[model samples]
Target: MERLTGRLVQMYGNIVSFLRKCIFYILSVGLIPNHIAFIMDGNRRYTKRLNLMQGAGHKVGYSALMSMLKYCYELGVRYVTIYAFSIDNFKRSPEEVQSLMDLMLDKIEELLREESIVNRYGIRVYFSGNLKLLNEPVRLAAERVMLATAKNSKAVLSICVAYTSTNEIVHAVRESCEEKWDEITLLNSSGGYVPDESDHLIKVTDIEKHMYMAFAPDPDIIIRTSGETRLSNFLLWQSANCYLYSPSVLWPEIGFRQFLWAILNFQRIRFYFDRKRKQL
Candidate 1:
């Protein structure tokens, strides 16, 4: 009976996979997003609603994220980003913050495994944020995964931890300025001050190149779960013209239905944008 049940489950999964592919084929008729970003919200609320142990919602939410990533890759999205941890999240109670950190560490290791979704999809993993703010163990683990996946160029997955848009912009600007200052110092050492406009000015492109998110294009769609419409300091600079999707489902309960709806809406908007461009 156990073997029969296992076969039944396998068959059910196979059917679902086939159906999903068929839907994806239909979706290909329209232009789809090359990049998508997710703000995983409402994990604590999901845990409370499900009467689970404290912090268990994050585990479930991780599962949902994997499923979403799989869907995105299968649908040909080349870039994906997740707001994993915010700098302000440290303001939570000590126990809760530690619990989240522990969870992040474990997940980072799992992502490095050979059979993980990242390897299966040939996705390069990038941690985009003030990684120095992470505990040593978590920071090192993130670095290791990045090194391990550096060869994967087919797809990209960016995890934003200890991050905020304002912070990212400031960090990028500082790095760009430092690079320019080094050049200026070298040039000035050989001769007097060169009062050139180009040397004195920092261009927008310079700062953008130093941005942690420079590896991927601006997200075409940003999905925030729990029906939250605000960005909350996530990708504010990169999302100048991106579409935002707010589903009513909590993070742990999120599924492909929400993902599909988001894509459909994004494609609809893209259609209008394309038409407007043609008129010009």
Candidate 2:
């Protein structure tokens, strides 16, 4: 009976995979999103609710992220972004902050391994944010992984660490001004030219060019778990018209069903978004 049960479980898994593939095929016919962003919320809450050991929830959350990444890539979503850490999270107790950094360093190093998702999916990994805020080890690991996979063109994965939308906007604007300062001040060969009013105005393109999330197009859907509808300063500038999906399940509890429903909703409302964009 034991042997029979094990075989049945394996068979059931195979059947599920086959069915999921069919559903994806049908989903592809109607609009498949090019970019999807995730605000991985409720990790601490999940741990507290379950009475799990300290830091266990994050480990489980990482596994859930891997699964979600697989589903997105398999469904032809070329760009995926996750809010891995926020700038405000630095206010946490020193011990907790360091613990999360340790976990980040470990997972980032794993991305460089041969069998990791970055390799498996031909993903170009990007660490998008004020990476300088991270500790030396974690920052270095992130840089290494980014450089190692910079050539992969099949898809893109952007991990936002030490990030917040307000900070990103401020940083972009600062960079934009500095980049154009020289031309604004010294347009003439003799260096005696007065700055034109137009030269002082920063264009939308200039700001966007300096944004951390510039590598991928604006996300079509931003999913925040644990039934949270708020963006929490994730991607304010880029999310002008994207759909916000709030699933009731916590981060670790999220799965294929929630993901599928989110896609279905996006497809259903895609027409309205398209029309709105045309009007804009």
List candidate 2 segments past 4 Å from native: 1-7, 188-191, 196-200
Summarize candidate 1's per-residue lDDT along 94-206 as a digit string, tens digits: 99999999999999999989899989999999999999999999999999999999999989999999999999999999999899888778878988667565654588899
The CA-based lDDT of model 1 is what? 0.93
In candidate 1, position 220 carries an lDDT of 89
Worst 10 residues of 2 by lDDT: 182-191
Write the residue-wise lDDT of candidate 2 on 107-131 in tens digits.
9999999999889999999999999
The residue pairs found clashing in candidate 2 are none
Error of 2 at 4 (Å): 5.7
- Model 1 off-target regions past 4 Å? 194-200, 271-280
Clash totals for all candidate models: 0, 0
TM-score, each model?
0.94, 0.95
